[model samples]
Target chain A: MNLSRRDALAALAATGVVAGGSVALADDGTDGNVDPADGVPENVIGDDTVAILAAVGSVVYPDATTGIDPFVETYVSGRLSDDPDHRRGVVDAAAELDATARDWFDAPVTELDRSTCDRLLRELGVDAVDPDPEGSLSGRVRFYIVNELLYAFYSSPTGGRLVGIENPVGYPGGTESYRRASMGEETEHGRE
Target chain B: MAGSDRTPAPPADVCIVGAGPAGAIVAARLAEAGHDVVVLDAGPRYEPENRERQLDAHLRPGMEGPWGTGGERDAYTSSGERHYPLNAARVKGIGGSTLHWQAMVMRLHERDFEMDSRHGVGADWPVDYADLRPYYAAAERELGVAGADDNPFAPPREKPFPLPAFPPSHSDSIFAEACEALGLPTHSVPNARNSEPTDDASACVGYGTCKPVCPSGAKYTAERHVARAETAGARVVDRAPVQRLVHDETAVDAAVYATPDGEQHRQEARAVVLACGGVENVRLLLLSASDAYPDGLANSSGLVGRYFMDHCFAGVGGRIDRPTRQNHVGFNTTECHALYDGTDPLAGVKLEFLNYAGPSPAIDALHADEWGDDLLDSLRDSYGTHLAVGGLVEQFPDADNRITLDRSTTDDHGNPVPDVEWSVGPETRRAIERANEVQRAILEELDADIDWIVGPDETGPAYHHMGTTRMGTDPGSSVVAPDCRAHDLDNLWIAGSSVFPTGGGMNPTLTIAALSCRLADRLDRWL
Candidate 1:
């Protein structure tokens, strides 16, 4: 399926299909060897919340699922642990998604299949509206849910590579590296 | 609000208010020179270890600004023609705005000093570039400026920059091609960040977030000076916002400040230096109105808060077919000061080739309608293929665009907050229009599809405040004298950009530091 080995292993390990092997977590480009699930605090958000976010992430980043579950879990937990007001917004968005899934398909978002979850997000008008946190139901869902998943994926080292951004904004990639032209550039002439 | 029931600290040789660059340098120099120095800051001291977390807050959407601004304590009213975002760039902490600044340290041009003589507009500085030459060298050394002598338009310098300049970023090469085609000169920008490791701080590590936070301590912040001042036995009292000055006609006897515990204290000193930025410096002076000086202290001319000025910015962004490799470097490396020393009747313009231009991959990914493969495609297509050029345009000082005390609005300590009445004059608007023309020309030369253009109407301040409490030789027209001493008070001196009689389309921090060192030297000789 043209998936990287890291993505395959992470997809396997997420469903308990693999065990005991260390998964290469989202490389912040600082420390790449640590396991994602090792140091996450207890119940940062909710197990269902993480599961629903991972499902949304698979749709947003269908081809770049390297450590999808643990990465999404870590990202959601870290995000929820920030400001209390932001945490409440995310939590409320998760509840609304779950309620919508139950009314549409007689199941929670976490219980639905990947395609069904994708369909649920599309039916909720998340694609049409602007991503505003304080907007209507579709807008809030897009902001707190869809955009959150996208941010997690693109900011991660593995996912950043898929979109040609190796080191995202916050990560420091030594000053010497920036002097060179990016890959696929013709001229290398920015030196003194 | 009587202050007789408050604690009073022992007298200091020099009392410097506001622990920003100006105050910190003054405190460090005075304390190191064997004088008792005291620095009072209205904000908390941010720990260095929290920088990475602050960068996280900066990266995340919908979070408070990474500089720790906002809340009731930092409130101010903008009763101006334009609603100035006062808190948008200010940091009240010990490091001050330098904590979140871009770290450029270009000196004001030689022509900037003689505006009245050269252009027959604005007040001429009491001290010229030659007078500040030695101190500019000293400030560059003190701040660890990394720069080259590549800028031919720069004023005469006695010494080379302390550290070597950073090479142009990869994106700069793209702008260089377009600029070279159009006969525009681009030179290395002098930055206050170190290119190599120093005794205390690390070198530039390219964290790509120099604006809100520099995780590696390469970029200079005023806290470093504050630390040096403390090491030299200077007393730095944080969370102490000075209410008013207890002064007679000749001198300021003491500064009455409020603490976090709701207790007021009178800190007496032989000399008081108001190092609090341009806005607050004027605000504090106006707030200290007494029967002797009913208008305000150091305000006998009634020009304490007059001549408010700020640099208005203009920007243009577009997408080139080839990869411009934007956002790889956080700060700009190449800038054009070619138009600054020109005969343009409007105002001098300094163009910057911005490295961190275009939408980031994460932002582009979120805005994409198609999820999955299409989102990644959209990011790869747009992220690296964009370039932008922006610059600061000079603003003429106007008496109407001033800062007065908002008696209706009060900060946390029940003191009247600063009411800014700022407006962009026609000269500034024309200058910004010219800057936009040059920027658009460069983008058009690149054969790029222009996405947006921010002209004079859409422009805002570069957050470089100046001109209020302006310096002059005459006592009747200005607030401070040649040596930054208040015209009305012998012992009261004003520091920072508030003393700039005419700002010259440049980042004012280097000039601020230079003037600060000069002020310190003057105090050292006097004491």
Candidate 2:
């Protein structure tokens, strides 16, 4: 059975023990912030920006009853513990996302309502994504998305419990064929 | 002066040389069956923090990246000084060629195994499809391939895939839709990367570097199998290059290693499995000169280096008008899966549309950067705009297109290195031309700016070299029996694509994996 995302998370939470330090959260099919590692950037994200990001992230991916899980908060927050690269990039994206929100609606991104944030995000998402065709933002967005999701997905308590993915047994593919001629008899052009 | 400390090692129950995909497979399987196994590879262990740089001679000059520094130290020069060359694409690492492969997996058609019976050109394998289906299933389970079990185009297998097809990249889905519009069916391309974390390794982060060592554990490598065997009591000696299979009439006595201290340690084995892959395996056999077989042990047929073959490559790409959601990480998308049955005008031509590995900066600097605005706009819009469709035409085995010993050249270890004199055959060249035509047609159908081009006739290296030591039914005509056992040597075995008596019109990864699995099962009874 295709186990509902909730049942999977609840089962893991009940166990209170899982691999990869999974932080239970949502899965809205968006490929952003998917890593479950504990390398999400913090401090770089000011208190106001962090709230805005959480709100926006939650709205973009709400904690539905049948959702894959939840927006792994503590997990994503931990990824930025000391991550210099993502820390630097998230601060800049937050500034730009906040600046764009202010220009659109006379308020900081964290202060703005969900609907207003959504509107501004839709309008500014184009710029935020592929921000600089020739500049380093191409690399920055990758860092931002991964760091933002590190806590959200990879490091979550339910992180290792992904859909259809598993710990491969033996050789994922079989071992290479035998090489040397064994002592067994060689049949009609076929010995095996 | 020789060091007084050096002494020959003891005999091993089974000595599987080279920890490449082929060798690792045999070793892992044999070890699984509770046999004593000693695995050796030329490369030392590598990690992302201390990864080896890979450089190809074909890369443009002044190219700076992790790949640029690959050939810096281990460069092997060709006659042309244009390239400060090294066969760095082929590594001495634990995983072997799979370390650098794109992980395109496909099963060879029935004709591939029995080419002579149908095509009347190559030799037919003694082991048929029925003998290999179970192993193919096992291999799929091991690699965690994300594909439809009902792939209508390729050869048939016993069961469905362990996982459903992964979500395609935006452009890949669009191109696939476009191909469907043009009366061509598309399916998920087989890849060894995880759609989800199925192993202890990290999931596949969309860094778009599947052709190199995957930073995350999402992709499967030999280390997994090596680890499994080692846990089950196997000895894996990394950084150990087996210079020669020191053997005689009875059995392989031992292997002479060229270690760091310029010393030779003869490690013996009751039986030896040569898993060094196409070029090096043949080179190793030829290098092993003895009283019985001067040309090479198991060279009774003189077919060791006769039928060299590789799939011819041609690439094509252009911009897609709509932004696709497929640009996400993981096994994002596959393009052009159903194009090789030797029936379509492009039959011998296998198509591989662009997956996630997007454009390179130098290539963009050369082609995309026309005007400032257009350049920036294209690059920005092209965060997923550029869609590439690559074609791999079936390369017929040419007797002359071979790898021979260049008595003069030597690697850092000072062994007489292998010299490859290879070129495309007529049928393959024609197939490439036809596949290019199909690509151009698809580009036109997609209705993107028809003028832009990436690489139409330009060729990439055939890192997937095959068919050097082809296995066949006849001892005089082929090198090995169907089970990959060499014809002349009673205790010598061959693995890898070299025994691919016939190269099919698909990526050789899945077929090689299946064949290896089959060999392992046979060895269960035979050993």
Candidate 3:
């Protein structure tokens, strides 16, 4: 997690993916290169796992988040690249999800339509179960897949603004901004 | 005998143990006074550049490595009635706990000094508030305390604080309205954080991560004093934990400490000052047992590790309709000490209006059962609407609630670790319940939906360790005398909250600094 933006860029280059490289890798599933959205090297997590995670983010995230695919891909790659133990758990969960999708729809989760993917996740009991990394299959999926995507989205500056938390805990915008009573215009979207 | 093979270091005029606020101030003053001082600390000097990474560690789920304190070196045993998370709020680094402290630095009340005489419960401190008034002012200037003379309940001060007070947060303003309705007084809490730019550190930029890490240099850590001590020509030895005090019946000879190279060295000094905090102070004394004093050096009363005390925390939090702008400012700005000065037996409660309350939007969203728009809605409803009141209540010292050597378990150095057996009696429980009642009234005045409440049974320590090596006039019942010198040993002295006779309701760091200053002046005169 302490890996700087420059370090991340270097890591991406080391994995044969350069910054602003190409969308061809994302378009064609055959190539090992990931989508050059955030320049998070796909070598940490596989392209198929990234694709399924992106699809899952679409189902869980608000419909307004049209950029969820790139956002999730970038977030997951960054998240998985931090700790090896956590990466193994997340990777295993993604594989479990892909296997479940193939068993039900006779195809991978990324190939399924949006509505079918949503139904499939709910049917797998991810929506009903509590997120536990060491719990059942549904719990692991909810924890490593669903919860991970949600954490990535909400903790981001853009996603935090969607719910009126302009300056989240991790991001230090500045000092004097807290003197203001509210985020003002930004609070309107989250307000009832 | 441990470090007998190694050549003893050149003798210093004074040798201080622990580089915390207590030891730092003592060393700085002594070194500035042209005395040769050497300070031995158990931890490393953390770099300021790593604060961003420390903040990231705090932000991560489960808050791993926030203070970077753990593993074998920082190990201890807790056998309390209520399980004490010993490492929860401690930083063993060069600056000590001040590196991650919230920086609230209020003076102890006059009543806190005369607790036994007035309340007939805890023992009275040998030195009263009047004795420490000058030192209190000096400590405030030393730490750059920012405050307003608004608290009607506060003890009389000679002058205004060094810096102006930080403005009350938006949530504190909201809570102020409720407090006004309940006839409770509210005022800006005194903070060691800079309100404006000082010579040493910058003005607080409200990084909002004051507890685990302060990204900005505005917050005062004891590192400033340590730096000053070093600049004043005090030799500071970090990663050199003092193993034991080499002592005699009438006086102390030297301090034996262990270094990283797996070698022990004897640091000979004319005078020794133990400033290793409440728990370790006792542990070091007990570990220094010799043929001359089997009950521990300067512990003829057998009270070296007795009368351990800490402040118990109580809180009540609930959600309101609109945004309270929670966590906009990391530190609390408002507090009420009315209950602390009251005549009631359950009066030692100091209430704080927490600026940060409830969980972050990320946490709420992550834990939500709903995924899509419903999760977003839940986050909006729960994110910033939280308002909470926290209280710090005093725990009177009990002989049974003490720290002893856990010889059964060895530390990374293969030495016996400190075994903490802490427990709060009925008085503490009553005080916490009383605090919750006042907190509930303030929250209910705002028509908040009462959700969570931390009553007596659920309360935890504020980590203000006190009264282990208690200071009193009597040698029969106390370890140190009124001047913070050992009752048994002539040349040895104690610093920090470990010498406190009673644990007051306020934050102890300011008081700890004040006492350290007083001890320095005393030691200077003696030397």
Candidate 4:
């Protein structure tokens, strides 16, 4: 079934009925309980970025098609709470990328355009390319976004199959036992 | 494959990359046979006459982070994303992985070589046990390993051990007694550390930190062989990553490398031997994708980054019911238990009672998660009383499990880093479950009520990734032939565990070392 506004409304009604007013909200990727319309979460990924993600991630990650929660969660986690070093290199190309993300969105990146989003991301240094450490912050953020998107993509079954990694599968090898060694007993000098 | 007869860069008779044991062996043998040899390594040039660490970056497990030890957590691809050929951390120094490895040299049983035919699974190595037996002996001699030579499962050898086995540590004796009590035979283990000096390096003092960089240089590494090759006039370039294996579809012409300064330079050779390792070797092949062979250089079968394997490992630790002190005779006994019954009908898991290093504080904290204050008091009361049994499972070959390069993700060198996509299959899970049952049974033998049992965790990565560029007789099915020469490209050879089609639940260093020796003799023919 298509996830229409009617379906969203019905789900929202159910959530509201199930839990009083403090139902956990994912308006901008925050884990806390908050109302989506009232206000946004602290450091939310933003509406436009989320829309772009829903688009790019849908193509990039197979998990998006099946709606696997863990991979999605990891992707969001990588974006909002990732280390600076993990950011996308596009942020390094700085001005050029920021403008493209905005132009691609046809507005501010806060309301990005999904169709031309990845292309803009590539221009900003999202895909594999020479790393530009010159532009630090935005570049780092872009890198993080890219990282999360890729992680989710691989975590998906399709991504896993294409890459040849057997995720959620059984052992590829066998096991055995033999005697070896370990640390010595602790003594007055020190633990062996 | 660049589709041009653009003469190979910096021409020489032979060019070998990475001055590790594998690389050093190939270079030394070729150079001694009067070939103009050049070996490129990404480590400081170590002069045997006078050794000093000039910008050495050796990273071992215990010494976390990229500080004193030369290991780095910067291996993740720059796609700002996932990187595979995942978890392979090599020392850029002259010695390679040997710099931080425990010098426990052991070979796969005869059954390991023919695991495919015997078990109807995995792929059989192109060469048989008999083909590698002599090479194993040669590698052991060169490394100066100390063993009892009485191991029932150990491959046969002509050379008597250079020295006796290192005296068992306090924990070793306890293991022997327990194994014997349980009707299991135990013997002293073979090690590369000398009780006395083999030549330049010192002997083992049992410092208990073998995983980190060895300060005494007692451990056998490519550093020694590199020195020998250097003495024989073989020039080794350090801090250079061989970017491409400059080759056409039919022949390996030369090697293209990026210098430490990031300047690109090409070094040509009549023959190029690859000992870069299972992960990097295959990755470098995939990345050098050219027109003559669009899939990848020397990748006729498209198997460059496929069939990745790691020995499945998990702990079997139990708290002593009562107060008991555990000590050592030393490390791995000559003989172990009846678990690794490769020849028996009851064989399922490859069992070895290892004397593993102490658990990290993080692991201990996890183990002592419950019981709060009582846990602290209990820990203090029974510290060394905990006995851990480790088992190595054969990581069978699966084409779906591999070391593929993430074209979308680049590395520090502006090159695509490997994005490892690994997860166990049903067969692996079944094996783990079966082996875990055995581990639990053995732990029960120690005490009545099991105190703490730890098996496979959710998120774990394997350090020993093997079988990516697997060896086989058929050029159609494998990347390299039995002699480790690339099936698609003549004179392009590889040495190390990367050639292994199937691993029999054991360490790959000895087998790699033996293969290096074998490749040396093969390269000596120089047809």
Provide the lDDT at B469 for model 2: 88
- List the candidates ranked by DockQ, beginning with the highest: 1, 3, 2, 4
Write down the RMSD of candidate 3 (Cα, Å): 6.4
Give the number of the best model, judged by TM-score.
Answer: 1
In candidate 1, stretches whose alpha carbon ends up further than 4 angstroms from where it belongs are A1-53, A64-67, A70-110, A119-149, A184-192, B1-8, B366-371
Residue range B1-527, candidate 1, lDDT tens digits: 01222355589888889999999999999899999988888887788876865775676554456776877888899988899999985899888999999999999999999988988877789999999999999999889999999998999887899999999988788888888998898999999998999997989877778997888889999988999998998888888889999999898999999987888889999999999899899888998999999999999988888888898888899988876667765888999988898876348799999888887775566667778877777777777778889999898779998989988988888888888898888888888888888899999998989999888788889998898899998899998988989889889998999999999999999999999999998988887
What are the TM-scores, per candidate, against the unseen true structure?
Answer: 0.86, 0.68, 0.83, 0.65
True contacts kept of each: 0.58, 0.00, 0.46, 0.00
lDDT scores in order: 0.80, 0.58, 0.80, 0.56
- What lDDT, from 0 to 1, does candidate 2 have? 0.58
Model 3 lDDT tens row, A67-142:
6555555555655553445666777888888998899999899988888999898998888887777888898888
Q: Pick out the ten consecutive residues of candidate 3 chain B with the lowest summed lDDT.
A: B1-10
Which is the winner by DockQ between candidate 1 and candidate 3? 1
Q: What value does DockQ give for candidate 2? A: 0.02
In model 3, how large is the Cα lDDT of residue A15?
Answer: 22
lDDT of 4 at A16: 16
Model 1 residue B506 CA deviation (Å) reads 0.7
lDDT of 1 by residue, A1-192 (tens): 223344333222212223224332223232322224433322246566677777777777766445567666655655554344555677678888999999999998888887788899888888767777787778888888887777656654445556665555655556765556754321224223
Candidate with the larger DockQ of 1 and 4: 1
Q: Per-residue lDDT for B413-475 in model 3, tens only?
A: 888998889887998888888888888999899999888889888988898889999999999
The global Cα lDDT (0 to 1) of model 3 is: 0.80
Per-residue CA lDDT of candidate 2, range B32-126, in tens? 89888887776765554333122111111222433322332233333321221237447676778776677777777666676667666555677
